[model samples]
Target: MNPWVRLMSKNVANICIMLILPLVFIIIWFYLAKSIDNTVILPSPAMVLQLLSHPSENLISMGSLTNNIFISLLRVLAGYILAVMLAIPLGILMGYYAKIFQLFNTFVGLFRPIPPLAWVPLVLAWFGISSFATLTGVERGILFIYLNNIKLSMVFIIFIGAFYPVLTSAIYGVKNVKKTLIDSARVLGASESDIFFKILIPAAKPSIVNGMRIGLGVAWMCLVSAEMLPGSLSGIGYLITHAYTIARTDVVIAGMISIGVVGALMDTLFRIFEEKKFKWQRLIR
Candidate 1:
């Protein structure tokens, strides 16, 4: 086949896999919905679509929705980013250092049992219904999601989580790395930082990206629940709650659809990052 034709074929296949599959399922869902006739509880796909067609009657025009959503998005983003930043470094350190793992493993064991929601009252009790409460509330909140989710969150609480796996695999990936490469650079007297940015991270990029991709998905899934905490009036979670109060099932469904769209968008962005930035780290093999 011509190169252009081959690429087009691949693109078509990807479209089918990524989009058509969902559409097929949705068609099935619509048919089933019509058969059930329980529009009150499980509205038909058509009903939901009709609801979506209705103009949004938001009370708080520009800033209200923006502020609310921004507040909620910021909270979740802050929590997740803090997690990725704090956890990855700790994971790297603990994975490399046995002593660090032993020291922190006990704390992980202690807190791992607790649910994030369990911290809500205490967070409110201690921090009140202000910003601080919402933020720290999630340190425990997003933890469980990322905890059961991927190795990154687990290691923050303990040593062996992703620490060992990531560390050990990283070491293995590095073992194959030519010793002479680092030795030559060291013989040239490159600073430790140079070696890390130049060698360690690049060499271990594959494993690192895998861990990150998993963690990102987990964190995104946790967004709605994390926003369910009090004092957040902007996110899709808050929107859903607000709509439910007035029995606006359409709005509630719309909020949920928005959440789903955001989740899918995040996933798509991650894939784009993987394809563009981390092509070398792609785990296709």
Candidate 2:
């Protein structure tokens, strides 16, 4: 088979796995739900959907369930975006500078291990019961994650979840170029900028795209943890908590389903972006 045809076949296989596996799991879940004879504990998918569709004061009002979902999403995006923005530059600096890296290593390690919940009280006191406060608390934790990720971005984390693995890969791709190539460029009297942009960045294209996909995955994965702020109504996490308080199993399950869907959507979007942005990067090998 042609290499391109083989690559396309592999892509199709991967997509099929992602789609079919989940549906099979859901079927098993529904079967188990019926077999257990416990409506309260494991509500079937249909039950959760019923709850989602039924009108309730908490779910139906304009300031309804969707409001919470949107609010939580906004918080996650804001916090994640801010953390990533700050992480990338600082990461690049640390990657390039020994003095700067050493100066902040201790501080990052000091509180990096602290749990997100641990900071809730302090963040609440400082920022109060607002979106800012909740997200700020989440921000602190993610900042630490990003900081650590950035510190390693140039090393290996960039390959996994650093700010943008693909970008980092692209950066290193050029740096790893044969010395002869660079020397030849210098012999040609090309400027430093010319050698860098013309050679280095283009070489790192695949790695750079990989980094973005990884970063986006991390951000989406952390969405729930980031939303666990102290205060206010709304969000999948908050919805789960609020529903649990009233012993509303249906509402809680509905929230879980919503969260799952949202998480899947995020991953789906990342995949789509990668496909569009780096279609050629996909390799059968």
Candidate 3:
């Protein structure tokens, strides 16, 4: 076959394979809904699709679906970014220096096993309904409303959820670096700074990126649970909770579908970057 034609054929085949399971799932869902004959218990796929089709349409009195999703995205990023910023450097140092690792390892190990939800009681007591608005002293106007929606407790929960995987991964990556690489750099008269940044960081970039991808997924997963905390007024998570309260199964399903789609898209972006930037890692394996 011609190269172009072969490439097109391969792409088409991959797309078809990707879609097969979802088509089967929808068919099964349609029949299941028909048999159940209860919109509250099992809404038809069409009902969910209708809500998804009109993404901007308001759900109940909270806000539009898209608006809720956007709010949730912001919350996830707020905590996820904090995790990356703190975890990477700390993890790198801990992995690189024996004393630093010894100093913090016991404390980290003590807290690492605790689930994010387990912190709810303490987090709530610490932050209550306080938000960015409270911290920044923004009392009124559009910004206040936006900032107030982001409760500190929620962010802390998400940070906890995302922190460990990233921290562990960065530590592992840096510690596992070939000793020869550092030795060679030292023999070449490289400064401590040069060896640290030029050798350690570059060698560990792939592992750190992989950790980031996992952290993002964890952070996103924490969203609904975080939003369920006190003072949450809007977000897809809250929307789903509210829909359930009113027996809006269709809306609940739609919210779930939105979360799945968003998470998959985010994962896909990470996968693409991994494949493109770390192709050598694959080849070496």
Task: Give lDDT tens digits, candidate 2, residues 1-285.
Answer: 999999999999999987997799889988999998676677787877776785354652224567566665665555446545655555444533468767865765565455444545555565453433333344456453333222111112111233333334433444455678768989999998887668545545555555555666565555454445443344566667766776667777787777777777887787787678767656623
Ten contiguous residues minimizing lDDT sum, candidate 3:
142-151
Could you tell which candidate, 2 or 3, scores higher by lDDT? 3
Error of 2 at 132 (Å): 5.2
Candidate models: Cα lDDT each: 0.56, 0.57, 0.95
Candidate 2 worst ten-residue window by lDDT: 150-159
Best by TM-score: 3
Question: C-alpha displacement of 98 in model 1, angstroms?
Answer: 2.5
Error of 2 at 4 (Å): 16
- Candidate 1 lDDT over residue span 1-285, tens digit each: 899999999999988888977899789878877887665455677767764564354532312333344444554555556555555666555544568767876775576456555555555565443454333444456553332222222112222122333333443444445567778889999987887679766765666665655555555555556555554445656667766776666566766776676667877887787688767544644
- What TM-score would you give candidate 1 relative to the actual structure? 0.68
| Model 3 lDDT tens row, 200-284 | 9999999999999999999999999999999999999999999999999999999999999999999999999999999998897
lDDT of 2: 0.57
Residue ranges of candidate 1 with Cα displaced over 4 Å: 50-70, 132-197, 282-285
Give stretches of model 2 more than 4 Å off: 1-20, 52-65, 97-99, 102-115, 130-190, 193-209, 280-285
- By TM-score rank, best first, the candidates go 3, 1, 2
Worst 10 residues of 1 by lDDT: 151-160
